[model samples]
Target: MAEEEAVKLFGTWRSPFSRRVEIALKLKGVDFKYYEEDLTNKSHLLLKYNPVHKKIPVLVHNEKPIVESLVILEYIDETWKEGFPILPKDPCQRSHARFWARFLDEKCLPAIEEACLRSVDREKAVEEACELLKLLENELKDNKFFGGETIGLVDIVASVISCWLKAFQQVAGVELLTKEKLPKLCEWSDEFVSHAVIKGCLPPSDKLLASLRAHFETVASKELCT
Candidate 1:
C-alpha cells in the first residue's frame, strides 16, 4: 500500500478515546498519520468518515474507516498480528476483557462525569462512582495489569482513569479515586501511565490539568446561566 494510503488516524489530543487508538497502533508497531481534529470546528473529512456520531479517533486503513475506539483497537490488533496481542487469544478471557471495557464506558464513565461536573445529585454521583471503582478494584485482584502482566485492551480503554481522571478530579474538587479508597486500582494507574508506550501517549500533566480546569469552569458557568 502507498504510504499515504496505508493508515490515517483522525483524533484530538484531549480525548482518551483517541489516545487509546494511538497507543494500540503503537503497540502493534503500525505506522500511521495522525490528523488532530478541531472538535469545535470539525473538519470535513472527520464528518465524512464518521457521520453517524462525527466523533474522533477514526482509523482509516486502505481507504476503509473504522469508527469507535474499542472497535478500532480490535481492528488494529486483528490486522497487525506480528506484535504483542491486545486481546486475549482464549475466547473466554477475551470476552471477560470486553465485558469490563463495556462497564467502564456504560457505567463507570457516566458516574465519574457526574461527580466531576457536580451535577444536581453530587453526593449520589460520587457514591456511585466509588462503587464502580471498587468493582474494578476487585477485578484487578493482584494482576499486574488488567491484561495480566502486560497492557491490554482493558488497560488501554481505562487510560482515561489512569491519565486523565486524577487531573479532572483535582480541577473539579472531587476525590473519588484515591490511594486511601482503592489501593490496587491506584497502583495499576501508576503502572499504566508509567509504562513506556502509555507515557508517550499522555498529554503533559500540567497541560491536562489546565485544560480540564477550564472545561469544568465553562460547564459550571453555563449551568448557572441556565
Candidate 2:
C-alpha cells in the first residue's frame, strides 16, 4: 500500500468499540493513522467520514469510510486477506463467533450499563447482569478465550469486559466483577489484559478509573439536582 493509501481510524481511546478496531488492526500488522475523535465535540472529519452514525471508530480506508466497529474489523480482515484472521475460515465456527459477539454487545452490555447507572433497584439490575455474566461464563466453558485458545473476534468484541468494566465498577461503587463471584470471568479478564497486543491497546488502569470517576460524578450530580 502507498503512503496515501494507508488506513485512517477515527476513534476515542476509552471506547471499547474503537479499541477493538485498533487491536485488530495491530494484530493484523496493518499500519493505520489513528485520529482520536473528541466525542463530546465530534470532529468534522468524523462527521464527514461517518455522517450516518456520526460515531467514533469510523475507519477510513483509501478515502472510503467504514462505520461500525464489527463491520470495520471484518472489512480489515477481508481487505488485507493476510496476517492473522479475525473471523474463522469455517462457516459454522464463524457463525458461532458472531453469535457470542452479538450476545455480549446486545445482552450483556445493556445489563451492565443498567447495573451501574440505575441507582434505584441497582441490586436487581446487578443480579440480572450477573446472570448474563453466567451465560457468558458458560460460553467460555473450556476455552481460554470465547473463540477457543486464541483471542479472535468474540474476544475482541468483549474487550470492554476485560479492560474497562472493572474501572467503571470502581467509579460507580458497584460490585459486578468480583473475583470470587465471577471466577471464570475474572480469570479471563486477567489473561486478556495481559496479552501483548491487548496490553498495549488498554489505557492504564488508574487513568481509566479517573475518567470513569469524573463521568460518574457528573451523572450523580445530574440525578441529585433532578
Measured by TM-score, the strongest candidate is: 1
lDDT tens per residue, model 2, 24-99: 9889888888998888899889999888888888988888899988888888878888778899999999889888
What are the per-residue Cα lDDT tens digits for candidate 1 across 1-226? Answer: 6643489999999899999999998888788999999999999999998999999989999878999999999988888888889999999999999999999989999989988897787888899899999998899888989999999999999999997888988888888889999999999999898888889999888988888888988998999999
TM-score, cand. 2 vs. native = 0.96
**Candidate 2: global Cα-lDDT?**
0.87
- Our tally of clashes for model 1 stands at 0
TM-score of 1: 0.96
- Residue 44 displacement (Å), model 1: 1.5
Q: What's each prediction's TM-score?
A: 0.96, 0.96
Q: Over 4 Å off in model 1, which ranges?
A: 2-5
- Candidate 2 root-mean-square deviation in Å: 1.4
